[model samples]
Target: MTEQPRLTTREAAQRLGVKPETVYAYVSRGQLSSERAPGGRGSTFDAREVDALAGRGSRREPGTGGASGASGELSFRTGITLIDKDRYYFRGVDAVELATAYGFEDVAEWVWTGEPAHGSRFTAPQQFLDAARLAVDALPVHSSSMDRLRVAAVATAAADPLRFDLDPSAVLACGRMLIPTLVGALPTVGQHRSGEGRLARQLWQRLTSQLPDEASIRLLDTALALLIDHDLAASTLAARIAASARAHPYAVVSAGLGVLEGPLHGAASGLAHRTLAEVLERGGAAPVVADHLRSGRRVPGLGHRLYPGEDPRATALFALLGAIPQAADALAAARDVVDTTARHTALHANVDLALAVMSVAFGMPAEAGETVFAVARTAGWLAHALEEYAERPLRMRPSGHYTGPRPPRPLPA
Candidate 1:
């Protein structure tokens, strides 16, 4: 049997001369049809339908104009989070302020249920903890923290018979348990703390060999809250797509983790870490910035597509770091890099830069920022999954526009 030709979203976007999000908008409106590619990689559009849509030069409805890689403009509605030119909002509250005022567990409950939480606590079940530990220990000793997280998610699902429950309340409850378990499952280089605090405190214990003071732990919490959700990132879309199929909550998280492991997404912070490390080792920020430009490479941790002037998250994190006397040197290096990068180009330091700065300032491992992002983003993913579950299932399938020659003359049958 001959397989029908198809176009990926990126290819369809090019054919129609529209953004990728616009292509998704077309799918959402039923202007185009799509199906899951082999292995459920992503949706593929009918090539013929896409070509037809492209010929017509489709335009989305007004008032929906915003950048999104998955859903078109505002074609898909999400009450979870909003991103503007300067600030990110989670359910009408400023994310930076929210982070400062509350722990990430509170942020998780708020975004997932749309209500501020009072004294919420997250703890892993003993059985789930034992299972997660077995799973984590099964991985190679050199596996990244994210690798452990992925394994833990799958293990958690397998251990929970009720994981298939799709009710919002059940899903939210799973999140409350899953977040802490996921953090606990990681390989902690330091001495484990005996008492309990928040997720960030526990996570800090996992990532570093040193004990963190109250101020440092608070900064880590703020960072986690700030990273909780940001509209529909690639990983979020992956999570939603999985949820749209009614996959288990743990499976939804697995989908998100799969996408986040990509270099261009979650791993981008590690790149920024390397860049900043170079600046410190060279004893001058300007030289490294100039070299990156001369090589025509993007200065890692700098520039963002959505925010023109600055990343408010970056501003907030930097402010927190500035207030901590222990972070003075790390803060100064970050500023120098920012200054040099700005002088050479219009780019501004973004959240990735901030994450890298935080990790460096706190003496964490190279991928610690990525780990934080993955953990924090799980809250957003689960929220999006809930939203997708409420909508019609399998609505994310995208139709492709065929551009190839007519089917091989019927295979000369």
Candidate 2:
């Protein structure tokens, strides 16, 4: 059969009177879908999709105006991260570049303070770690990693006498200590690494018992750094709201953790992990994808609403994963899933798929991705909270429009 013609990203952008980056933005927002070009160097768009979106005329960019709803227009000026076109940046530097070039501790410090501190390490104080571990150990044996994380946050907060201090420097210190504490509190799966080194090394011990090579450790570090921030995710918004209320840094993280429990958010990676495992077990992507569709479930680990094309983070991680020999089969399974689904939908792989590849390849649990997400994103939540603390307290309050009966009506009988 003759292959249908596809437009390159640049061609699609030109056709739509937008920049290539905007073309990617359209994919991220689900305004468009993208497929991999031959040789897999760039994305190609369905000519029809691009022309159809063009026919709709130029729409206002997201965050430019509020939609009609009970929640009025809300926007905030942030210097931390910007999601543009198909790539994202932290303080105007490419996030993928930053993540790949530095350790998770360095990248996270840069995200929070705008300067990368080389060789920086986060160490959880013994007292705080003790308190957090106690809390985590008290949970039911079956409690998820996220559950342990939440309890640890509260316990850590209680152990700090100055958690009420909202000073910028004080808050930053709290962040430095809190992140390591969260990681240290999780029950280890194999050998226990000392708590005095790189955050990723400590986290590796907790996730799996397999001895990791340099490449595997590098992959894990990059994943954490890449996930450190995304502009105004649901959990970030919640953390900002908590910061606006002058909540302490620990409380702010707790607030973000609360929102991460929803299946649509942090849990998405676990779903993707299960999906990739199924594809591997079933020996093909076709049946797995078919089973999901037949069950009326959208396939996980594909298509992100924010990038109409490839998710840049996924692109970067996948590139790194390709170098690890242990990752070959799982990575192939991920590609199979993407290729299989692409036959029907133009959706490309997202970070969850890459993360699932890591989890499945390393023999980690389904929920390992959630743990990585929550711990890595703690840095971002704190960064947003730092921004919010500088703004006027309570500035996030949006007035609600009354949608019920008139206020003048008497109380119900």
Look at candidate 2 and tell me the lDDT of residue 66: 24
Query: What number of clashing residue pairs does each candidate have, in the order they appear?
Result: 13, 7
Q: Pick the candidate with the highest TM-score.
A: 1
What stretches of model 2 exceed 4 Å from their correct place? 1-73, 192-195, 407-413
- Local error of candidate 1 at 324, Å? 1.7
For model 1, the superposed segments whose C-alpha errors exceed 4 Å read 1-74, 408-413
lDDT of 2 by residue, 277-384 (tens): 998899989999998888989999999888999999999999999999899999999999999999988999999999999999999999999999999999999999
| Cα lDDT of model 1 by residue, 61-84, tens digit | 422322233443324668888888
lDDT of 2 at 155: 100
